[model samples]
Target: MKIRFPMRASVAACALCAATTLAPASPVAALGPTGGGPGAIVRPEATVPQPAVLYGEGTQVRLRSGAHAVPDVTALSWVVADAASGEVLAAHDAHRRLPPASTLKTLFALTALPAFPGGIRHTVSAKELLGIGEGSSLVGVVEGHTYQVADLWRGVFLNSGNDAVHVLAALNGGWEHTARQMEDKARSLGALDTTVVSPDGYDADGQDSSAYDLAVFGRAGLRDPDFARYCSTARAAFPGTEGTFQIANTNRLLTGADGVAPYPGLIGIKNGYTTNAGNTLVAAAHRSGRTLVVTVMHPQAGGHAVYEEARALLDWGFAAAGHVDPVGSLDALRPVPRGATTGAKPKTAVVASTGAPRPAEPDWTQTGTIAGAAGLGAGVLLLGLRFRYKRASRA
Candidate 1:
């Protein structure tokens, strides 16, 4: 079955395989993984200040009188922004890069989730499960067990399992390929502060992200239905060798586990902890049709600080909306034109809740050819695997 690309498409459809993917450089494409070489797309330089003037080292918020001040917390980096309008309400060291821990999985899910359909089943191989980080969390996915793609995703969200991530990466090609794709996706989203050294968000020597970039990920993930569902799920049944077992989400604020009081209207994005990264969280909540996303990274207060800080920010954001102007924006920086003259500065456009000329839409005719062909190739491979999986199941 052939797929047709709709004009003004949010995602592109490949003619060769009945599938759609982020169509090249579309706005949605900028938010997810694409089928392209790691360096195929030119990105803004990391040093280039995004949302202009967001590089300031201290807190950035213009509070009017009678509005309570944002809570003082020990987070090294944090940001709170309007999800729909992309207006950053307040931020502190928003661009400061720090270790990301498992929170990097948000980017991973954005990149890899669309590549596999949930009903597709993949058998775990010993080799596929190899190279999981030592001391990393596991979902107890035994080798030789076959799992519906959905089950593995549950393992990832609920248990933060590196083993499940490895299996999914193997399906997407391999760890290195998925990591490179993640890097490409991050740049596409204008998350310039993140460096993807590991696809599973394990603490590698240089893997890192910043509050601004992480909030960007959370906002983008909400655009996808599957990404939203998986993260918000509080519990799920994961298949194991012995039997199916229940796993609860590690996001304390979402599940109200670990003595943390659940925040009303909380939406699960992700949470992470590692010796190097400390505690990191990306959380979103909706009240009165307005949604806010918050990112807290490497808080010094320890235990529950990440969740509490995020909760406090959300409260402040909802109340502070319209009372304050955006400190910055979450809009992705425009990519350099493919063959622009060397050293030409890329245009820095900011999308705010206030009226501003939005960035120009990418010319799909010019860019879609390459992305469509790439999507076609990926679609074929995935379809073949699905057919094989079905045949094996029926045998």
Candidate 2:
């Protein structure tokens, strides 16, 4: 069963153009919060670390007496958190802003998904395909082909299709409008680090997100029944000019493609890579009725380091759940209540936090058994079935 939402159309007129031609790649100067020297980033109040400790440059974790050490990785930034409670198990530079690459699609889906339902079909117009970046990934969307909204989302999730994103963005109003909506949505979700210059998440100047914000996007996306279905879809037949073609999910952990073994109880979220944002990933899995979300960004080591590090973090997260206390929170910040005439500093809601002191150097060798939230799968399936029945009855 699949579910979709109603989309508002705000089509802009433009002469039909040719399908996007791949152009020669030029080096993109890294230019965002990350390009600034260290300490250059001035975070929004919403993006500030909930617990003071999350501000540290090194790994942050508070383990109980018996808890094993967290797996060490070379990720520039990463976060592991419970999807249900919003408890951050551990993180390193979680709020340090950096390029997000295609993983920013999670935020895109969060913003635009509900407006375009699965059953609604749109005919692809050449105008809608304009402005895709040179050297961008595509899922082979062709002009004049009519496709279900669901099909386009499959292309987005499985192929990281920037073309599909542009078409959908056009439908949502236009590329710029969709980008604005994504930015607004990010702020609403307390993802203050994100700056959306391209709705498709093609690298643009000043566009970046932190591991904390990406995990926040992933956790929030999984809560939506439609989003859960789309992200979790492993493979599907995509509508094409010739006919339907098969597209498999690019998330290595979910599909076990490219020698990365399929993670047990793994559920899809998103993955991304570019010359700048090397191998960013956001993954969630369910085990023993608990759901865990992990985000890894720009590991220093090249070649599958992102996925391996994410997997290792997941292992440590599940194993450390009961043993380690939450160091911070993924909860969005809210206005702190203030008295009209009081001269006192304002404070946001008190987030759950507890942890032991960090070791001088993490013991990466500590091994532990672990595992995802099972309830969400059941809920998503039931919601999809009910929505499918309703749509069928209407048909």
Candidate 3:
């Protein structure tokens, strides 16, 4: 379908004129202690802090004895999940809120990609590029030009371009509208920690997502054929006056940049970095016909920690695929107006956690692969902590 996107100049002017808008805030008093029953959503986490492995409320990864060579990455939050089943194999600080950087684009793709056909073309305006913040990753586009929806998407996936995302958002309506829609999509996917504010994932105050939520995004994005194709693209090119502007995929796991061996089953997802967010990544890999998705967020700087950390998790997930038990499965979100769909599984509720440090064990009692808990001044909710409202842009 052919759709008209907003003029760049007008969009830029609107961006400049904007004031700080508050997020959808929930009443602190209305939130009860963490725990849920049938029809409840649960997000799990570790109460006692672990330095390396994920220690949240969900099931733990079971590595075969003498099979543990995974590096301890400095990333603050990360999760490894089986792609087909959405089962979380292992995670560290999986539910902690952290800057998402470009990985949030996976969410945008989930919400916006299937809306526009690949061949659709739109004019580019100088003003549109202005809407992207300074130091934001860009897929170079000239103002007063035109390009196809596919090209814009290529820019987004290959280069982590804020410019490409802005143009696409304009096609969806505007930044404000697209942001709200992306967040709504996050809700439907059972990504409770995500509060999207920018479609391109530019770092913004109050913009945040958890490692587990990112895995949710990757899983949902991969389900769409177009999203999977775009992310897996190893290289893409855009038309330009001087010449064809070509770029390699930013995902090193796919392209093998920085000397890291290209993973055999690496699939494209997305990756991002900013001062606040450090390095973040969402990647999926297939091995022996089994697919797994790994999300690593806020890794400490220096080497390719984001990619390496993700690589380690992927290796472990493939090795541990069937041998160990799943601590939890990332639930497909129940359709809103809960149970509206026939045979849709009811959102399961989790009982409140003790909120104390303890040894990690199978989450048999947590109820249904426990996921989110609401904030009560720092008390950990055992599972889905559904907040009434409140409110990812790049870093």
Once superposed on the true structure, which residue ranges of model 2 sit more than 4 Å away at CA?
1-49, 332-395
RMSD of each: 19.8, 26.5, 22.1
Q: Of the candidates shown, which would achieve the greatest TM-score relative to the real structure?
A: 1
User: Lowest summed-lDDT stretch of 10 residues in model 3?
Assistant: 348-357
Report the C-alpha lDDT of model 3 over 267-362, residue by residue, as the tens digit. 778989887888899998877767788888887757887887788888877777556655555763323342233342322111111112122333
lDDT of each: 0.81, 0.79, 0.73
Off by over 4 Å in 1: 1-50, 332-357, 361-395
Q: CA shift at 299, candidate 1, in angstroms? A: 0.7
Which 10 residues in a row give candidate 1 its minimum summed lDDT?
344-353
Better of 1 and 2 by lDDT: 1
Best by lDDT: 1
> lDDT at 216 for candidate 2?
88
After TM-score superposition, the amount by which residue 282's alpha carbon in candidate 2 deviates from its true location, in angstroms, is 0.3
Cα error, candidate 1, residue 101 (Å): 0.4
lDDT of model 3, residue 142: 76
Supply the global lDDT for candidate 2.
0.79
Reference-based TM-score, model 1? 0.74
Worst 10 residues of 2 by lDDT: 10-19
Predicted candidate 1 versus true structure: per-residue lDDT over 249-365, tens digit per residue: 999999999799998988788998888998999998878877788999998896788888888888899999667767788874635454434332232111123223245556667
